[model samples]
Target: MSVTRVELAGRSYEVRVGSGLLEDVAVQCGPLLRKQAVPIITDANVAAYWQEAVTGSLTAAGFEPHFLVLDPGEATKSWQVLEQVVDWLLDQEVERGDHILALGGGVIGDLTGFAAAILKRGCGFIQLPTTLLAQVDSSVGGKTAINTRAGKNLVGAFHQPSLVLADLDALATLPSREMGAGYAEVIKYGILGDHAFFAWCEENGAKVVAGDAAAQEYAVDQSVAAKARIVAQDERETTGTRALLNLGHTFGHALEAETGFSDRLLHGEAVALGMVLAARFSARKGYISQDDAARICAAIGNALLTTEIASLDLSCRGADLVAHMLHDKKMDAGTLPFILLRGIGEAFVDKHVDLAEVGAFLDEELAR
Candidate 1:
């Protein structure tokens, strides 16, 4: 297992990556467990695959394991669902110092992390990220959130975990489509700011996508390291430095809103398309030449992100897409800022951008 750390002000955590981390979770939590009983928050789908193994491990290590099995899907990451989870934790008598285990994909990790952040006015939690995206991105940053009617992750907090266990074995069971969804984020780290890793992904992304062990481990470790560096520099996103991580998020989140945040558009898929749009937009702005944009798209293409985002028919017009951006969190004083690139591995936030200009650009992309 490759263990890494995200060191922050008063909040730091270990992110352990490899196979069967679930089996060793109890021992991993030994130092944090203290007399703290462990409450596992997962949904029916994940419970089917991991409940028995996780419970046995936690129990054998002398930590009482109580669970809150929730309804599955993006709809479950809502205020109503969060209320249910909070109520369940209360029923389990979870205390402020005690830790909760978020045991599932991004949805479960996100929902549980938000719940853990607010429960008892911010308690402790752990991330047992089972999906590739969660392992590399969402689980480590402590950006816990629940989607609001405004947009994705509108209601959330910065609550770091005590430990994060990314079990590569868990990815074996993910559906191919979901696997593709995750590969988008892995490609994102490379695209957003890491030129060398981006090149590495271009070379080995197919093998990683095929579930090659070494390839998978390298992807996770490198992605986590990239994210950790960003998180360490800007933990709460108070500075624009961390905002670079939103490379494709602005466009992606708008796409998610346009689709109503349903199965029509998965977050990572939206990100994939969003990155393409960002790269293309950068070229349009003359910040990056056409060749650089082509290279970025080629790398994303090799990783299968462009096709996944393109999976959605070219039905929604760009004007329609811009309408969805109306609720974007990055907007301030009626203008939406975007993370555009000057070239590969280079990203900068463009706050002075005119919304009407982006709208015009979206029109052009949709027309093509």
Candidate 2:
């Protein structure tokens, strides 16, 4: 097992990446298991696949773990579901001292973390991210949020987890499409920074998706380590350091809005295509060479991810997509900062982008 520590200003936590960690949760969580009955939050899908291992582990460790299983997916990240989760946690009488475990993918992690943030003016929660996307991206960062009708992740908080148990074994059951979506996030790490890591991914991403143990571990570790370093520097995203992580998110969120945040375009897949747009857009602005943009698109295509927005059959024009982005959570005083690449592994926050130009660019992209 390899452990990566996220050092924040006043608090720090460890991200433990390995196989069968969920089977040893009691030992890994240590004193956080203050009560015999530990409250957990998961989705129905995850419960179907992993409930036995997780519940049985706690039962054997002398802890009676109770769970609140939610309907899986982005819809669960809503006011209605958030209210349900909070009510369930209250019924369980979760205390600030006791840690609530989030045992599922990104949706579960985000919803549970948000609940922990607002519960009794903030309680503690641990992340047991079962999916590759959650393990590498969302689980490490303290950014917890739910979706509002206005936009994705518009309602949320910055609540750090007590610990992150990324049990690689859990990924063995993931569908190939879900695994491909997760790989988009792994590619984001390299696209935003670490050129060498990007090259490594280009070579070994297939192996990682194929469930090669060493490749999986290395991809998760490197992605988490990159995130750990960035989070340590800007835990709250007050500085620009952490914003770099949004390499493809700004465009991706717009794509998600177009799809009504449905499974039609999973967040990771949207990101895959979004990175392609960012690359091409950067090229349009003369920031990067055309070859760099092509290479970016090629890498995404090599991973079997979407490189063309036209394929998704979005119902709106480019201007409509821009309208959705205007509602983004990252909007600062009516100025939205877009993360664009100068080249592979070199991403910068561009605040001077013209919305009119962006709208026109999306129009061109849509007509393609």
Candidate 3:
């Protein structure tokens, strides 16, 4: 087992990554429970596979486990579902000091964490992230949010989990498409900052996705540590330092909106293509060489992710896609900042981007 700590002064927490963590969850979370009843929120898909182990563990520890199984999908992160989760937590008689367990992927974690944040004006919650995307990115960042009609993650809070347990065993059950979706986030840490790690990913990404134990552990540990360092520095995103984490999110979110935020483009897949777009756009702006942009696309394509927007068969024009950015949460003072690459492993925020120019550039990409 490897542990990475998110150093947030008095709010510091540990993210433990390993196998069998779920089977031993009761002992792991024992110190955080305030009473016998433990309230857990998860999606129906996760409950189908994991509810038995978690229930048995908590029951064996003499704790009464109560679960609220929600329907699975991105749609679950809506106002209606948020209200349901809050009401369920309220009925659980949860208090400000008690910890609620979020036992699923990003959707469950985001909804449950948001519920914990608003419950009694802020309670504690632990993240039991069961997906690769959650473990490597969402589970540790304390950015809990639900998707709204306007945009993805537009309504949310910076509610940190008290502890995060990322169990590698869960990946064994993931579908291949889901594994590829998660790999996009894993490669993101490299694209945004670390050149050496990017190279490592270029070589070992296949191994990591193929369920190699050592590669998975190293990838999860390194990704968590990198995020912990950034989150500790800028917990609220007050400084631009933390904004670098959204390397491909702006473009990715726009693609998501165009696709109706459905399974047609998973968040990570959009990110994979977005990173390619960001790299190519950077080259167009004379920031990076075309070869570097091609390198980025090749790496993504090697992972079996689509690297071109042209492949999406979108009926909308690039201007229509740019219109989607108008509602982006990152838009500041009517100018949306984009995370563009200067080179491999070098990303910077460009806040003065002209929407018209972006639209034109995207128009070319759409037709390419």
Candidate 4:
């Protein structure tokens, strides 16, 4: 068991990650929920896997439990889903002070957090992250969002969770592919800043992917601690620190968008490939050695991601992909700053990057 605290201006909370935390949820979250009308919002997939134990805990504690279950996927992270969740909250009579439980992966957390943020102008919420991705990244940060026709996470808020319940037991139900996707984000913490942790991932990521308890706890604890520290200093992403977290995402999101945000490309896989390309591109820019880039790709392969992106012969060109990045939510003043790296453990935001150069590089990768 490992616990890390994320402190912000008015809202600060602890991210408790470990096995059997779900059973202790009521005890741990009692003060956080404040005994109000708390609603548990999940998707159909997670509901099938975790609905019983979660509702059982709430029911045992003598609190009324209402559920809002969405169809799971990036497609569900839309304005339509937002409307449906808001209606469910209205039916439950959820208030500004009440808590909404986001009980799935990133998609569920983002939609539910946005709902809580806008419900009567900001309701409280708790995070019950069931997937590794949610447990480490989405569940802790105040960054909540819904995707749009323009791009992913185009509409959202910065409403933080009152309590984040990261139960490793919930991960037992994850599909192996889904686990790999989430692991991509787990590796991201190391790539962005922490060299020692990056080395640890190279060594123990296999243990985590195999669902080892201690490795799972450490991955969640360290990842959350890294993100919490960044969020604390720059909650709204005022500085470029939070943007570094998007390391591989800009290119990955474009791949997702081109595929119409379907199962053909999961978020984590996109990040996995995107990070590979980012490293490759950095090597092309002479910032990092090709050997360093190869090591990054080797680490990604050890996690079992299909990094034969070179062999994919993707239907889209680098120029086409660059166009998709234009829709990125983080773009500013007509220039899209990229999160590039000089080496494995060092990531930086480069604002003046020329898109044509990025397009040429993508074109080369796609051809390979």
Encode model 1's per-residue lDDT on 99-208: one tens digit a residue: 88899989999999999889989889989988888888899889998998888888988888889999999988787667777888898888779888888988988777
Q: Model 1 scores what on Cα lDDT? A: 0.84
lDDT, candidate 3, 182-295, per-residue tens: 889988889899999999999988888888888988999889999999999999988987999898888899999999989999988998888998998899999999998998
User: Cα lDDT for residue 259, model 3?
Assistant: 97
Candidate 3 error regions (>4 Å): none
Off by over 4 Å in 4: 34-37, 310-313
Candidate 4: residue 336 lDDT (0-100): 89
Task: Write the residue-wise lDDT of candidate 4 on 1-368 in tens digits.
Answer: 67788988777888887778777767777776755456889999988888887777777887666787889888899998899999989998877778888889999999999999999999999898999999889888888999899899988999999888898888888988888899999999898898899999999987888878788878888888998998888888878878899999988898888888988889998999999989998999999999988888888889888675654447888889999999999889888889999887899998888899999998888877
Q: Give the 10-residue window scoring lowest on summed lDDT in candidate 3.
A: 173-182
lDDT, candidate 3, equals 0.92
TM of each candidate vs. truth: 0.96, 0.99, 0.99, 0.97
Clashing residue pairs found in predicted model 2: none
Error of 2 at 136 (Å): 0.1
Cα lDDT tens digits for candidate 2, 1-368? 99999998778999999998998988898678888989989999999988888888888888998989889888999999999999999999889888999999999999999999999999999999999999999999889999988999988999999999999998898988888889899989999988999999889988887778899899999999999999999988889999999988899999999999999999999999999999999999999999999988988888788898889977788889999999988899889999998989999999999989999999898889
**TM-score winner, 3 or 4:** 3
Tell me the whole-model lDDT of each prediction, alpha carbons only. 0.84, 0.92, 0.92, 0.86
